[model samples]
Target: MSKDLEIGKKIKTIRKEKRLSQSKVVEKLIQKDINMSRETLSKIENNNRSISAIELKAISEVLNMEIGDFFDEEEPEDLVTFFRKRNFSKESLKEISKFQDMVRILLNHEKIYKGE
Candidate 1:
């Protein structure tokens, strides 16, 4: 799939996961002075229209997600599903917990390195 479509799919998935309707998202965008119509948002979510940087930023804010989340090659939902579908042993669970901690530490270090 195209990158634009991928990003749009991510946006739609996250919006739905957050229990937000397109109209509700548009309402929030208006509160942010974006003036987006629900139709426009639908088009965006369907990959029928391109999104501007400002629109993307406002949408991310309304969705309570970072803009970078939309651009990630791996979907977070996939990882969640993988974990949910697995019946791990105690040792495996412990290893997963340690891996999660390491990932957190690495992310924190990356943020600090970037002066974020």
Candidate 2:
């Protein structure tokens, strides 16, 4: 499949996963100053048209994802999303960040200890 088609499939998958309709996405896009018709979205989903970076950014955010996720496989999880998925509260997430930092420090210490 073409890159554009692959990206369109990814978008469609995310939309379905989130239980969002194309009209709902269009409404959200309006909030981001992206004025696109449902037909335009259909074209995008069909990969009959290309998406601009601005529109992609707006759509990705509306889909609650980073725009880069559309292009990259194995995209790194955003910390906020990681914590939210685990049902972490904001305060708890900040604490988790501390713990994550400690883990990195420990890993670095081990690397030094191993002289690698």
Candidate 3:
């Protein structure tokens, strides 16, 4: 399959996994100053249309995902779902975010050390 088609499929998969409707995503996009229609989003998701970088970034934000996750073979765990499942308090969530940042930094350092 083409890269665009692959990306479109990933977007659709992530959106569905997040339990989000195309309309919901489009609404979020509009709040981000992106004027995409649900129909257009559907087209993009179905691989009938291509997505621009700006649209991809906006959609990623709406889906609460890092853009790089879309290109990965393994699906990322939905952090929102994780928090909801645990019923974490706001303070806990903030601490978790800080811990995640530290972990990310360590992973980056490891990659650099390994010359990856």
TM-score of 2: 0.61
lDDT of model 1, residue 99? 79
Local lDDT at 34 for model 1 = 100
For each candidate, what TM-score against the reference? 0.62, 0.61, 0.61
**Model 3 TM-score on a 0 to 1 scale:** 0.61
Model 2 agreement with the true structure over 1-116: per-residue lDDT tens digits: 67788888888899989999999999999988999998899889888888888888889999999887888676887565798898988898888888888888999999999999
RMSD of each: 10.4, 14.8, 15.5
lDDT of all predictions, in order shown?
Answer: 0.88, 0.88, 0.89
| Candidates by TM-score, descending order | 1, 3, 2
Identify the superior model by lDDT, candidate 1 or candidate 3.
Answer: 3
Each model's total of backbone clashes: 0, 0, 0
Single out the weakest 10-residue window by summed lDDT for candidate 2.
72-81
As for lDDT, the candidate ahead, 2 or 3, is: 3
